[model samples]
Target chain A: MTGRDRSGGTRAWGLTVAVLAALAAMWPLLPDYNQITLARVMVFAIFAIGYNILFGYTGLLSLGHALFFAAGLYAAGLGARDGGLTAVPAFLAGILAGAGLAAGVGALALRTAGVAFMIVTLMFAQAGYLALLYFNEWTRGDEGFNLPAASRTVLGLELAGADMRYGTALALFALATLIATWLARSPLGRVMVAVRENEARAAMLGYDTGRVKLAAVTISGAFSGAAGAAYGLIDGYAGATFASVQYSILPLLWVLVGGAGTVLGPLVGAVFMFYLIDLTSGLTDAYMLVAGAVLVLVTLFAPRGIMGEVRRRVARWLP
Target chain B: MDFGPHLMLAAIEGAVAAAVLALTALGLSLVFGVMRVVNVAHGEFFMLGAVLAWAVAHLVPGPAWAGYLAALVLAPLLVGLLAAAADWVVLKRVQYDPERTIVATIGLLYILQQATLMAYGPEARPVAAPFDARIALPWPEWGPEGLVLTWPWGLGTTAWKLVVIAAAALLVALVFVLVQRSRAGLVMRATQFDRETAQAFGIPVARVFALTFALGAALAAIGGVLVVPIQQAHYLMGGDPLLLSFIVVIIGGLGSLRGTVVAAILIGMSDGIVSVFFSPTLAKILATLLVAFVLIFRPQGLYGTRAA
Candidate 1:
């Protein structure tokens, strides 16, 4: 409360570039297993970044962002699989779908706040998940459907290959990070923070808190949807599993672990959690047991998350 | 089957569903009403109950009825104690802030789920019912005579199903008596009505919260024990009940016990009939949307006067 964040100062762009370069540089030295895990981490990082914009920046916590992510995933997947659109077009469609769905859901869900907001979003997402199952003849339900390697190609460059896949995943993750950083430093971003901190005060000062929330959700949804689309391209498949309540919770976990509201935190969190599960999984079937405990411990000890704590103690210039 | 028998069959199945749902939703309603916190792990507690029942049932070296009886008594109590511990360790630390409570409970949900997956293998194992005499149902229809009783094939339900309904009713009555007519209920109501005021007046608010959390978990566990005989005990099986009960609590007007019971029965009983006319998933979609719209348009539910 004392040292309030003052944007436009912290060499944030340099930090962003440094992180991206480090990710790219590390890809060459890593083994195949780590590379794949790293790629998967980026996919989730993108999701957490988008989620942070709403939860961290805008102060709205949603339990149904999976609906938007799935909307993007299915759109991109089905477009490439059936619509015969190229990968790029499909990905764009995914972004549009994600943003579109978020707008739609946020419009109604934002009517209620706090716990009620969580429940509304959750119900809608659950309904969407059921819809996926109900239309399994097309969506393939829980098993999901695959987009062929040919459909994954961009300008005859096959995305099925590891190098291309990882590169594309990194590129998208970079773009998502840039978007998050820009938003965090932007005036609109400050308005979102204002809404999060004191909506009544922001409203009294002639800000439309509702519109700010809706915009935040829309952008956040687009990022989530884009992540889902990227997953379809990189993983070469899209499944109903990605649209489950678990999917929604994963981004939330990543954002929390890495540092919510920090541009680099989502990626950091995603990397940490992915390894946490990966390493734990090799040892036992109940990987989530450790993950769950981590969540509980983190929530108890690091209420502000890894990045949040860092921002508080080490660097007041995190933004 | 004719429409008459089909409808009746649907009604009976719905009643069975409603019976279990009412108890589960009522538990959720009590927690929300008293503590003003949502227990996302409530379903996991139910799953724990069923799993424990299976363990107890198998461990007891006696008849299926003996195992069933032991499980019926032990499952809920154990689950309640576990819930109380969780409240003390986690919720108490967070001071029951709504948002933090959500996150913490979600973590608790994952812990319980993963633990169950570890302990109880990923099999949907069933518990043997204490008594399951299949009773054939008779429908009345006008024949050559003024009235005739026709036995419907496949219109039969097990006696255990009836017992479930009866037991649910009894438990509901007990809950009502405890909350409305007991000294403890008075304390609980006071805490719910005003937490700070209750604390100021010498009521142990923290202890009340722990007890209420335990009670809610116990109710859900009892529901699981009652259901495991009919359904199966699986770690993943908790999802639907949790979703359904949460919806019931919301639609019943969020923290209204009477409203929760009525909504549970209406939704549960109508589900079979609705699915008869439509697919079950479709019915679920509609129900989910129904709750959202209810919250959106009429935050106060059909029977609830309190605005959500």
Candidate 2:
């Protein structure tokens, strides 16, 4: 509704650098327990950022991104276990699997728009989840599979410890955030915004809206997939629950609360929700009740999300 | 393997499934058709109905029939009221923005589910059927001289199951009549057709929306009440009904009542046969795949008019 940019590119870059520096500084100071939780936050942050490419910037509200996330995690986890490959190779396989799955699903789902697109993606994700459940031989269904401790080692770093896992998660989160920020500023990102703002107008202007959307979905899927891989590596477990609709909705809650389109929204939302869950879980097992209540309050009161609202109010003060 | 008896059994199972699915899907379809907001918590309402039925039947001091009857009438009404309250407290505050309402309903879903879990516990509980006289199904077999009817002992269904089918059909018909014939229906249709214009013409648009939402929930609740006797009630029972209802709604065409019924019957029947013959998981997979196909090839659905 108002101007978001108030200064030259340097301000935004500086802000990002400052935020990353602050996060990096907290690594050593955070206790072991907090470190593990923070690692999870980082993985989910990666998910939210990738999800933002389609939902936040591109105006696609998918309830099925968990499909790709799980795909990526399983691809990497299983790849490492089955192929006896190292972290980098297994992670690469996960990216390919995630991207490939996204491309395939995107090609079909892109044909529909609005609510139909959401349902279509959900259907695909549901089917994928069911497949995971039924094909117990591969996925172990709901029983879940534990990663062999050795596979946790990525790039010669043994990630069996909290510090190493957290470090890996931090590096991945930084890379994902930087990539997402760069993409958001790219010409392709502008086109994605155009498609989001008005699809018909973008099509009239000779942009293949479908192709643009497909590209966005694929990119988003790849990021989610990478996040999934990292998540498994960080947690040392993989399960069909990774692909559930609940996981799909989790990032949505994060992005919506943090701020949909903003680069920092996912990070903020992920940290806020991660801690919120931790705090509520400490209080009672009925943490979901609290989470659900927060979702309602935020959606009703802060539909633009915390950062989005803050930006709107303090436009001149922000990048 | 002789498949005739199995086919017959599957058809009977499908009929029962279709009866309940029609009610649930119809509710979802009505909410979408009228309010233009997808209540992601629609399944939760169905769960509430079943759960409440269990509560009412258990807590109310009466004969089993009395409790069953009370649940049959009261559970849906209570859930309807709850839905109406939700519409007022939450949806109205948000101005019923489609996307935002979805998130709100998701929140509502968690709240309802968790609340149920806290109150009722996670274990599945079965309600005693009002009357469950087992009736043996007769199949025509060719004798040496002529065709004769042979009774199969294993192929027997409870009279209550038939009652469920009958009751659901009657309710569906009653809903159709009320929507088509009543003055309240007129208001709902008016609001659905053009909310702004309807408001200009002196329609209580908000009330109509609220009422429509309640009615939708009530229908699903009624469906849930009917099925609780057959399927055990649990906090997690809502997920499948929600997904199945969505599949029915999508295939039948969003907001198309007639299409919803047709699609429900098709899906219900297929699900019944497949689940019995193959596996329930396979049935669900097929349904999900069918939704994908419908979305890709016929996004407008079978009966949905193309958006102008």
Candidate 3:
């Protein structure tokens, strides 16, 4: 490989290492509240990353991603509530259920392109939300469902408190990030990009565009499910709000604000947006307003996102 | 079960719903037809119009009817100017990238919604109907064969909503006439069909785009103002109609004005009928699912060309 290629590889590796080290160092210093908040951010980042696979990679925007997330949350919450399963098993059940639900929904939704995809996905998500509301006996509707205070354990290591939960979240975040990065470099990933660029051309080149999109959406849903599971476990509560339109749209904003189509974009976007929410809420009751303004500013000025801008600047400096 | 009352109520609700939905979808359809950009903030413009009307009607010191009239005339005009500014300031920059435009509009939506929340608070605002008069239809007597037809008292909100609907229909007809017959409409059609060709012909393309967006915003604002009495005005009220308009635009086919009106009626009637039997949430689900089925089977919508 050329020196430039070697340098690029090194830089990517370096960036990942730096971020990991920083997170590890900050873990011990974070307060209990902040730890929980960080966990929430990581979970949302995972969700956003999953969304990126469809929107950023496949060039298809699914407005109903919250459906899968809610599926996971409900699955885990119900499993735990039933008293038939432990936290780990319950979480696993949630993940599987979420993936299954997403796959089923994606099969139909991925049939169309552009606004059709958006509208169909939204319809499915809204349907899911309505179903939950209709079956209020199970989902508890607006009041939300709470878990029976499950302890956290990792490979028989009993760390059954907030710290342990935070660590577990960090570990999951790492795994999700690694998987996303690897996926982006995989052959399937390349095909997704090709499909995103031009579906007709990709089809001419013997690629099954629909299958590729379905796969991307399914995988994305699984990751989002994992995030939802984490949210349930950490918060000890799950509600229809998790499945609402707001959840779906907020993550899209995160992806856009953080610079979608990149490994770090969702993470950066989630952290920035969550903290911005905290800051705005503190300043005034109209936090949504500030959040909305920030979104507008970001979209207007930095369509590539903050990371995209950083990457561009870094590239210029290196050259 | 006697179907007469149900059918009558459904028809009345459907007509009102269709009138408003058509107005809202008209702008969205026009924008998409002309600019090839999906303005996600279209609903926000509607909300802004509602809020503007509320403010003007309540805050202005005048007779109730006069204030209402002023609001009806001024709110949409003000919103149209705001929309035109957005077009020039934000939308114009992203014209080359439609996806970017989508993101930008979403951001605009967020900002507008939040701003409304901050300014108006979360409370729903009531706008007094201009007239309290009720038109009563006589109740039908029950038959011996266990069949019954009953008509409860039917009341219309001010004649204003019907007037607004009529006026809007007339306005849309005028637009159609202007677009299909006039020189400006020819330019708009020409530009929509081929921006390069229109530019080549020296037809100021950008001005047409700005005008179309303004027109769409104005239409949405007009709908918002008219809807105030039927539904209370509020900041977050735009979301439902926005979703409905999106479905309407999609079902009607993008860029087809005729399709928009047809789809709006279809959706409105479907919603009105379904809600009579099903829960509101279930009705929403069914409505959305219907749209999805259409989208999957016919992505170009019921009337439009293939998805672009």
For each candidate, what TM-score against the reference? 0.95, 0.94, 0.92
Give the whole-model CA lDDT for all candidates, comma-separated: 0.87, 0.87, 0.80
DockQ of 2: 0.61
Q: Model 1 misses residue A234 by how many Å?
A: 1.8
Residue clash pairs of candidate 2: none
Summing lDDT over every window of 10 consecutive residues in candidate 1 chain B, give the lowest-scoring window.
B138-147
- TM-score of each model's chain B: 0.93, 0.92, 0.89
| Candidate 2 per-residue lDDT over residues A124-243, each given as its tens digit | 999999999989898899888888777778667888788987889889998998898889878899999999899999999999998999999999999999999888877888999989
Q: What share of the true interface contacts does candidate 1 keep?
A: 0.68
- The per-residue C-alpha lDDT of model 2 at residue B307 equals 27
TM-score of chain B of 3: 0.89
lDDT of 1 by residue, B170-232 (tens): 999899999999999999999999999999999999999999999999999999999998899
